[model samples]
Target chain A: MIDMLTNILQTTVLYSTPLILAAMGGLFSERSGVVNIGLEGLMTMGAFIAAITSLSTGNPWIGLIAAMIAGVILALPHAVAAITFKADQVVIGVAINFLALGLSVYLVKFMYDAGQTPTVQKKLEAVAIPGLSKIPILGPSIFQASPFTYIAIVVVILSYIILYKTTFGMRLRAVGEHPHAAETAGISVIAMRYTAVLISGALAAIGGACLSISIGSEFNQGTVAGQGFIALAALIFGKWNPFGALGAATFFGFAVALSLMGQLIGLSKYVPSEVLSMLPYVLTIIALASFVGRAVAPSALGKPFEKGSR
Target chain B: MSQLNKQSTIVTALISIFLAMIIGSIAMQVAGYNPFAAYQALFVGSLFQAFDLGETIRTTTPLILTGLAVAIAFRTGLFNIGVEGQMIVAQLASLLVGIKLNLPPVLHMIVAVLVGGIAGAIWGFIPGFLKAVRGVNEVIICIMMNFIALYLSNVLVRNWLSEQGTDSTPKIPESASLRVDFLSEMFDSSRVHLGIIIALIMAFVMYILLWKTKRGYELRAVGYNPSAAEYAGINVKRNIILSMVISGFFAGLAGAGELLGTQGYMAIQSAFTGIGFDGIAVALLGANTPIGVILAALLFGVLTYGSQNMEHVAQVPPELIRVVVAAIIFFVAANISGILLGAVKKKRRAKES
Candidate 1:
């Protein structure tokens, strides 16, 4: 029983990687007062572009970079509209999601000669650190994971430093919390917020690339599979803190892993895989119902930054 | 026109869209497809072809409801991202009831649609309650609800409902199904149905309620300035919950339009069809006004239908349509923001003047 639990935990770590990355991206955007409903779209776009890049260059690193670029590019519209245009951030975010899914799928059909990319043989190889992998059972599980898993951990620390510690972080948080006050302080609220949102796009793209090259090694139309929403949940559950979000991501990862384990153990053979697949979503709802934590988002979170508001 | 001194906002919007179009066209051309052909196909397929046009109206039915859902919530100052989830939950409820109940056509239809709408209201109300009572952000809560709805639907379908509890459910009774095909025979064998009429009526009704009714005024006032509204003796929280519930009612209808009016059955695929999310764009493009939602929904309907044809015939990636929609939304949002900014600038100038 212990071994079974341990093995399931390993799969959970793998499953949660993309979500942790995406949630961290969302934290950057939301912390800066931009509601990034576009996370899903950016992730999807990243997945498609990453697939293309990996296939083209036959290198996962290139795919990761390419996915980031694509994500930022997709997020450009949201930034321009929400920040520059001062449109409703939520609406712009929604449009980004739709545009991302539609554009990527349309491109795949046009470019790939099929709705899916050809499955590639070359994939990201998992590596284990010599000393760390042998530390213990937990050590083996943790160290013998993808490089991106470690990156996720590092980025969480980085996001915390960037969001709470640095001058730039101060400006981003200020703009989100009170753009008018931030403006008076000469923060260039618009500029800071735009930068935060763009960073969100870049990070979300990385998450998408991680999703494509790391696990699937191929991209399909709906590869994102609501991981973006899961990330959003993590952001909420974590109460906008990076470390908290990571823990939230892991919790969801466990939800996913447990469902897989549930079936493996024949815990509910009567239920189908699709039903099990919905478990994460069900957990998200139950989480909301329970009211996980106090969400004190930037005061001006959804307020369209209209220059004209009296 | 002069009274609207910021004709510049509209001009800016047009210019942005023009810029987006030129950019899209250039991108398409660079990708080796004739941009001219693509645009021609877009316009011709969307508006001119009888068959395509019919399909557009069919797609527009649920879109209008979803758009209204978003618009109503926005009017109350709530960003109801959970419309997708609410729509799903309501849809499942209607499907379940749709098969279980046996009644006359009118009563059955009312119960089927109304129950679904009520279910959506419950979903919307949860976030509304959170925002009102606890100060939780509706955006996050609604999103969470959407995920929950999706999963719950899957679980229910697989366990309790498939083949009487299968991945698929029994076909809705004929009495429960809306007569969506009454005009199909007249419309080139297209699926365009009476749901379009229902959507138009709902839009008109929404417009009247928002603009002409006392409750509408309260909802609008609360949306504009919640603190001021509370100070002025309005029950801000109640109004908010009411607004969200109203919007969810429409979202529920949107789901029913798909299940009962369009598909006449239920499937797990029915959940989170993006209509709830897409409705946000519709609400924004329409300016969250009732008339705006109707017009925007129709336009979206045209785009979707035309893209489907463009995909079948031209091998032009139908995704370009999504890019165009995104570009259009970007332009529209930018336009509104510009107007608001201009208003602020004018106020400052007025103070100076």
Candidate 2:
């Protein structure tokens, strides 16, 4: 039973890392006043580029960097359209998702003559922390994992600090809550929003890199598999707070792990795998419906700020 | 000025399409393919042949319904991303009714289609209710509901509805089928059915409902400004839910069209049909107008059906069609033509002053 518990805990962490990273990314963007429905596309770009770069360079770290850069590049058009042109953010987001799906598949087919890339030569490997890893359940679940797992945890902490404990974070929140006021206070709303969105892209890309390099070990059409949306849900469920998103993501990861465990334990005979797969989504709806009333959004979220406009 | 505004919108859509074609050509060139030949093959494959045109019409049938589905919701200020989910649920419901019913042919088909719409309404109602009552973001709720619907449908198909070795349900009885003898014969025995006529009628109904009815006025008013509409005595919450139900009703019809007109059976979908997602593009290109949806749906149908021949004759990847479609959407969403028109308007204003 202890062994089974440990195994499940390990799987949960593995599953939650990407969600945590992406949700944290979403937290930043939403808190800074922009609604980013393009996280999925950004992640897709990151996963594809990360896989290709890791395969060619034989360096996972280099691939991770490439993934972040690719994410930022993909986000540029969304930023330009949403911020500068003041296009509908949701429409731009949906279009970006479609574009990413098409572009990635086209690139994969072009490069590999197939719909997915070959397994990378260099993948982010598990690092067993020397002293901490020897501890029973907590150690194996938290300390002994991929470097990306540690990075994800650090990201959560850093996000908390950056969002709640810093001047930039305060200005970002101010901009999200009331861009006009932020501007009156001499804060550059556009620049703050741009920075926030760019950070979101970078973090979301790292999440994608974690998927291709650490979890899946290859880039396929399904590598991102609605995980980005799940992250978005976690963000909403967490009320757009970094630590809250981290906890929500971990909860979802636990649900996913439980589904996998059900298969292993022959629970499939009683409950279909498809039904099990519905758990996280169903929970998301319930959580949103139940918590959204209390969880207020940034007052100026999804609204475009024009200079000297009320 | 209203006429000019409409003309500018059309011009913008046309420009976006033109620019997308250029982008596609550039991509083809980079990929070492002949763009002109590929486009030529695409046109010929979809338009020149009678049978191919029939295939295009058949494909257009579902797109018309789904496009209207998204368009209606958009007009009501709701983003019904769960059209895909609602369609799947309705598809499954229609399949169940299609296979299980023992009524006369016409009544059975009507019943099956109605069941689909009702099932979709139920699916759509969840998120709508959540949004109306709980203030949950409809987009997130709809997105979640989509996954739930997908997984639930797959389970239902696999455990209860699956035929012997295949993952699909048994062929739906002829009584529930929408196939029409004369239509198929006219199309060189293609899978074309009466669903196209139904879709056209629905488009007309949509036009009448949106423009000629009080309920539609209420819906539109609520969509434009819910708080103001509420102050003006419209039931904003009710309209929000009603809009989603109506949207889901059409999405359900799209699913019925697929099952009755095209597939004839519910196969376990390994992935989303993408017709629902594509509906967003259709609605955007259509300017959320009923007549525009028909035209846009036809165009999308041609591109989808023609991509196969393009791949065969020109050796271009069919994925290029998707790339082109995405490019068009990018340009449209960014309102590239709107920007150009604004520039023009500004120059005119300066001269007038």
Candidate 3:
């Protein structure tokens, strides 16, 4: 029983790491007043690029960096459209997702003559902490993880600190809450928003890299498979807080792990596997419907910050 | 001024399409393919070829309804991203009714189609109610709902609806089928059917509902400014729900068009048909107008239908068409007209000075 519990816990962390990273990215963007539905596409690009780079260079870290760059590059168009041109943020986000989907598939087909890239030569290997990974349950579950999992944990901590304990964080929040006021206070709303959005893209890319190089070890047509959107849902369920996002993502990850385990343990004979697979989405809907009204957004979230406009 | 605005919008849409084609050509060239030859093949396959034209129209049938689904929701200030989910649910509902019932031909068809609409409306109502009553973001809820609907439909198909040795339900009864003999004959025995006619009629109905009815005015008013509409005695909450229901209704019809007209049965979908996501592009390119949706759907139809020929003749990847569609969506959603019109007005002012 203890062994089974440890295994399940390990699986949960593995599943949640990407979601935590992406949700943290979403937290920064939304807390800074931008709605980023393009995380899905950004992750797709990251996963594809990471797989290709890791496959070629035989190094997952380099692939991770390349994934972040690809993400930022893809995000530039969204920034230009939503911030510079004042397009509807949601519409621009939808377009970006479509663009990412098409561009990645097109590139893959062009490069590999297939819909997916070849599996990476080097995947991010699990790191067993000295002496810690041997502990009965807690150690193995927490200490034996890929470098990306540790990085995701660090990111969640750093995001919380940056968002709640820094001057820049305060300014970002101010810009999100009231851009006009932020501008009156001499803050450059456009620059702040641009920075936040770019950070979001970078972090989401890292999450994508985690999926392709760490979890799946390859970039397929379904590598990112709505994980970005699931991360978005986690961000919303977590009320846009880094810690909240972490908890929500872990819960979703647990749900996913349970579904897999249930199927493995022959629970599918009793409860249909499809229903188990749907647990996370159903939970997200319930969480959103229950909390959205109470969990207030940044006052100026999704509104374009125009200079000299009240 | 309205006429000039309309003209400018059209010009901007054309420019966007032109830019996408240019980019697509460059991509083709980079891939060691001939762009002009690929485009020629695309045009011939989608337009000049008789059977392909029928295929284009056949593809256009579902797109028109889905586009209208998105368009109606957009006009009412709701983003119904769950059109795909609603359509899936509707497809299942239509399949169940179409296969289970043994009614006479016309009544059975109508009943199947109506059941699809009702099922979609119910699927749509959840997010709408959550958004209206609980202030949840409809986009997120809709996204979640889509996964739920997908899994639910998968379970249903696997356990209850699946025919022996196949992942599809049994063929719908002839009475429930939307295949029209004359229409198929007209299209050179292609898959064209009564669905296109129904789609066109729905477009007309949408136009009339949106522009010629008081409920539409209320919906639009609520969309434009909910607080103001509420102050002016419009039921904002009710309109939100109503708009979603209507949007889902159209989405349901889209599913019926596919199941009854094209496929004659529901197959378990491994992935989304992408018709719903494409509807976002269709609605945007059409400027959320009913007639514009038809035109935009036809354009998309040509691209998708033509892609096969492009692949066969020029060895261009069909995925390139998707890239082109994405570019078109980006340009349109970014308000290409706003920049061009501003440039044009500046030029005029300079000339006057």
Specify the highest-DockQ model's number.
3
lDDT of every predicted structure (CA atoms): 0.78, 0.87, 0.87
CAPRI verdict on model 1? Answer: medium
Q: Please, what are the lDDT tens digits per residue for candidate 3 over residues A44-130?
A: 888889889999889899999999999899888888888888777887888888878887888888888887888786899899999
lDDT tens per residue, model 1, B165-244: 35687789878877645577667777776667778888998989999999999999998889999999999999999998
lDDT of 2 by residue, B1-353 (tens): 11223555678779889999998999889988899999999999998877898899999999999999998998888888889999999888899888887889999999999999888888888878888888777888888988898888888888889988888889898889989889988888888888899899999999999999999999889878889999999988899999999999999999988887789887777678789988988988888889989998999999999999998999887878888888887888778877787899999999999
Q: What is the C-alpha lDDT profile of model 3 across B231-254, one tens digit per residue?
A: 999999999999998999999999
lDDT of 2 by residue, A44-87 (tens): 88899999999999999999999999888888888888788777
Return the lDDT, model 2, position B138: 85
| Of candidates 3 and 1, the better by DockQ | 3
Per-chain TM-score (chain B), model 2: 0.95
Can you list the residue pairs that collide in candidate 3? none
| Chain A TM-score compared with the true chain A, each model in order | 0.93, 0.97, 0.97
Q: What fnat does each of the candidate structures reach?
A: 0.68, 0.65, 0.73
Question: For model 2, what is the error of residue A85's alpha carbon versus the real structure, in angstroms, after optimal superposition?
Answer: 1.0
What docking grade applies to model 3? medium
